[model samples]
Target: MTSPTTPGVPPPVVDLDLGGRTALVTGAASGIGRACALRLAAAGAKVRAVDRDADGLETLAALGTEAGGAVEPQVLDLTDLDAAEAAAAGADILVNNAGLQLVRPIEAFPPDVFHTVLTVMLEAPFRLIRGALPHMYAQGWGRIVNISSVHGLRASAFKSAYVAAKHGLEGLSKTAALEGAPHGVTSVCVNPGYVRTPLVERQIADQAAAHSLPEDQVLADVLLKDSAVKRLVEPEEVAEAVLYLCTPQAAFITGTSIALDGGWTAH
Candidate 1:
């Protein structure tokens, strides 16, 4: 006779079943944010993708439709609090993914550069969360996922502002999770290693010029050198992580920094 299935274990469920839920993802025009918009849409959630780039946002909306899903595209500068609040109205999930990074030595890091990075990366997310929490509390269910970075968990050279913003985002997530707990809302931080996107591509080009080395070698040796996998993360891989956390199985998983860093910090 076959033994009964264990109580704690069940069959694998790949699809997230997010019907009736609405997820608002910032920076959804491209890269990991774009991947996340598509992933959440495919999971059966209504999507609202926010970005400054109208063209890219439209493209993402079309991709969502092609994936048997659909998104309402909103063109807005996330740094503007009014726009962020307007966009977040009635949303059940908030993905704070809009960020800007400018890498240079501290001395060369202009004050203007710092302001832009902080405003976009940290302040916008803070405002978005603050704006979304009240609605989420009233609804009795919500998810706030902040996309930090491996640099947030640790540190690296020539990236002071970006690192600081990421670290602060993690702190914000923890605090938000603690407060949202009583209201049945959830919050989490997703820290991914460097992925090959246009953003990262620009970084690579800038690094090549600065270090006088080939871009490929810089990526292979410097970026992923300490990582166990020694490879840049794929956008789709990060998207999978986002969907995993959106599932009911992750109900108890909040107030944590989940890393998709190819074991970068495991060393």
Candidate 2:
């Protein structure tokens, strides 16, 4: 079955060419990260797919090969800030897509989990950008796409850590844009609401339990409560936004977020 196009926003027709460019995508083993890696590779970029899940990375590599795209799998944990930074060196495009989520009230949230979320979601992106800027500055061009979320713009109960990290990411993305603009680099956030990813899938039961509802009800009433469209955003759709941001036509766009929230933020 085909998915419906976002209303009013026509499907993108821009032709992207990333020939001779190297793109580094964190958490490329699955979901939005996997989609973005494949999309960029199909556009002729040499993609470095990073993730701690070696098995998942293998699957992504095979998928890329089947699609006739160059995907080099790098098994690394994003929590290793230094390694994450080093992996981004020489990248023409950097997609900071690695993330984790925990749905718990601030009082109930584990401190370690919160720390892990911040380290991976916020600090690592900072380090990765710091590493990529030198090469990007030298070439006078680069694209940095941070996979933020609607949580960055609005708060939801029982998602303190994820919301906090995403909010911090928004600021970090803007800061990168400010610093990167002079070097011809653009930094932007792709804010998706409840993507159809493993992360969200795992949250279904957690959200159900947290909200005292069934899983299905959690999806329809809790997750989609604020979204007028009443559907989870697809990973490929988010990848397309990332692709669009990397195109020459998007050179003038920076320091802002492109919300793929199915009108969740429109509320």
Cα-based lDDT at residue 50, candidate 1: 91
Candidate 2 C-alpha lDDT tens digits along 120-152:
999999999999999999999999999999998
**Top-TM-score candidate index:** 2
Query: In model 1, which regions exceed 4 Å deviation?
Result: 1-15
Query: Over all chains combined, what TM-score does candidate 2 have?
Result: 0.94
Report model 1's TM-score to 2 decimal places.
0.93
- Best-performing candidate as measured by lDDT: 2
Please give the CA lDDT of all the candidate structures. 0.86, 0.93
When summed lDDT is taken over every stretch of 10 residues in candidate 1, the lowest stretch is 1-10
